[model samples]
Target chain A: MPDLAASSKRPPPWALRILVLTYLTIFLFAPLLALGVESFREGALSLWQGITEPESLLALRNSFLLAAIAVVLNVLFGIAAGLVIARQRFWGRALLDGLIEVPLALSPVMVGLAFILIFGRTGWLGPWLSQFGVRVIFSFPGLIIATLFVTVPFTAREVIHVLSEIGEEEEMAATTLGASRWQTFWHVTLPNMRGALSCGISLTAARALGEFGAVLIMGGAITGSTHTATTWIFTAVDERNNGAALGLSLVLGLCSVALLLLVEKLRARAHERR
Target chain B: MRPALTPTSRWSLLLRGAVIAWMLLLVVLPLVALAIHGLRSGVPFFWAAITEPQAKDAVALTLWTALLISLINAVLGTATAWLITRYRFRGRRLLATLIDLPLAIPTLVTGIMLVVLFGPMSPLGAWFEGHGIYVAFHSPIIVLALGFVTLPFSVRMVQPVLADMDRAEEEAAASLGASRLVTFLRIIWPSIGPAVLGGALQTFARAMAEFGSIVVVSGNVPHETLTAPVYIYGQVESGDSHGAAAVALALVTLSLLVTLFSKLMVRWGVRRHA
Candidate 1:
């Protein structure tokens, strides 16, 4: 630690510190504390009852299920995409690099709308797909697609960043030792990227778990069918079921905080290893 | 000279092609589809969708709140980043975790947090209502929600740059009898300026397209608090896909421009840092 205090030879600006504390408290912590209190106002039993309701339970289940599937898909795709971009010099690489961030830059709603335009009944491919009895929109498939779209870049970006930094020396050494390409990738590359991969997957899972706008638009938020925990919370609030809303919101918040903590841990561990 | 394709090279080629195709199908195709759908009805209808009074209000409110929130975020985020990067503080790790809460939590819950904190039912909310200061179902609440969602952007962006920055200049200034403020203004500001602006640009883009949190807080009041995303949502729900597409196109265009600008800034910052 550089002794900022000694260097300045002065006490810290207490006023500025207090201002930041006050601002964050008002904007972040206060709301969360209020949410906690409201969720528990009716006691733990009610909070339990709220999430245990069949619809809420189903919604929670769907959210977790979708997140799991999306995480798996994204990780696989991320590995392939990350390797291509990080290891290979190719034409249009810059364009592909730019495309990775397209999902992040656009609104979740816009992503959802794009799905609608691609997979909805009146969509370009929708009619053709429907001829074979395939349903994409207003279903689990829609939820998966939406979650995948929003989180598509997370794992890939992380892996690519890690791969680029670590370079290809280890893999080249392995290959020169007569190791097969797959052997080099698995033994040399995968181990090096494990920490970053986990961090990215966790981050993607967290984002997928909380996705709303795209899911709402693509899945249509149909209760007991396509409804996610987030969509359910939205409906609960809209229907004036504040108790249920607060309880579900608390549940979601807790899970997310836990996941974020995990991400931080993974990130710190990766940094130390690096 | 072009090398003949070996088995390993062929396999790698296949992998690259697969990843590229996957990305094209996942992001590029959907986006192209949206662009086509949005413009299918021609420019006159697109003009009409955007020129509607309600639509105009939504666009205006989105831009206004996004600007305010990004400015607030830039100043406060920079301060928070400075404190964390410069000082040895207790609970700094915990504070840093809290800053990333929004990224992990479902954004919809952000709105619920605000509602529970400032809704008419809570004590504080009731008191505010008694004093005729409304929060929920209003525009300021939208700004607050956006601020919460984007709070981490600038801080996260600047922290690494600040951490890696040479403190020798500041120490030299201090040794030369320069005030702390002068040291910061003369040495620190220029170093972190590009990063803060880059992060602020991304934050602004995020705020403009923010939906889940704002929807829950803003009450979607027509011509008052409804943002472009929510308005697009309403248009979609009402079976007005064209109208939704028009607004979505506008928001996407704005976000892409901001994202491109931010990317340029990132390049500039990296170059300058080097």
Candidate 2:
């Protein structure tokens, strides 16, 4: 790739480069810089104090808890679904693949609404679930489900891409040598796609942590109990508490930057291995 | 292709069944619930719900803004992709990394970032407001937030295609006395066109559904800056489940159509390359 660039006789037009850079500066970098500047505008001590308030702390904790649970569930489901789609041919396989991507395209608001239609007081499952004394909406379970819906495609999509590229020859060989299906999966397939899985996991974690719209609708963003970091930021902004909003935004922004860096490193390593 | 590697065994059957059941519960059930709930009051009520003045305005605003954002992204994203793939320069890696930042960042933070930069309270925002130009809490902020959140789509989509392109044809055209512009239009655009279009459609679908960032950035004035997702959120909050579901179902249907077309474009691109 480097050689190809070097071999080219002409450098790209400078105007195009400047245009792109200017766009990035105004649209992306400037806003990010503003976030950092404003977060500490009140000084570091105040920023720290704002983020450490009981509500903020609980919101952050809830975000982490939801993200953790979403990651585990999505990873397990992603692996199983990815394996099925890649390793077997069956009726509705293509349909299933397309369906998996539905969450990505659907509005998060719609996702919340859909669940409410199923679990809200007047919903189809409401009466049956009430008989069991179970509440789903406006609760932790609803928040986790909404996160899961949004993050569902990441791991499975990554796993499918890797599996398709690596092929089934290794698994076939293992099976031919008398390895059980589980053994072959554990020893062969899992080892080969570790990088892709991690990439997917990081993506899921980032998305789950950052989820807001669906969680807000589903969990009701009740101040202390239901507010994730994002909903907390929204409420903070609504209450004209710019200090807390900016402070928490800065923290989430930094976490996402770290996650983005991790994804890039993983992608680079995966490319090198290929 | 090769004789089935592992014949369907009882364990394999169980795995497939379990995966399918999980998908049904997680993915299909909610969609069905939503559809049923949306239509429960009959088509007239559903129609009236979505056609209400505020709902109509919200959907229109979302569509137009998303369209504008996608068009801008198409040009800028392709330019960025081309620069990164064809040029050797300092900070190129950093630029590439920054392109993906929007995806990794909590979108609510993205809104806060913009608000800090241009909200009415900030100096820049106050300056704009003094001139009667609203950046945050208006239609423009919707564009910025959507643009920020959807920035990476086209660039990421086009980058790989550009990198993997066989430069032989381009070089041949260059050596034959074709100007760079002529060569690009004749040789390069044909291959990347489908990818760019696919990416743009995906961006449009994504932008239409964006909620977290826009809700924070746009003040959500009904019949003014309110977007479809935010409007839906409002309905949900007000206990108007039927209205929310009807409008949500409309948004989902449109997004699904756009997504299906995007997939077709991608498949067409792959076939062309093959």
Clashing pairs in 2: none
The prediction achieving the highest DockQ against the true structure is 2
Over 4 Å off, model 1: A1-11, B1-8, B177-182
Candidate 1: tens digits of C-alpha lDDT, residues A31-113: 77877777667688877878888989999999999989988888888888778888888789879988988999888888888
- Superposed by TM-score, candidate 1 places the C-alpha of residue A68 at a distance from the truth, in angstroms, of 1.1
* C-alpha-based local distance difference test score of model 1: 0.85
- Off-target runs (Cα >4 Å) in candidate 2 are A1-11, B1-7
DockQ for candidate 1: 0.53
What's the TM-score of each model vs. the native?
A: 0.95, 0.96
Candidate 2 chain B: 10-residue stretch with minimal lDDT? B1-10
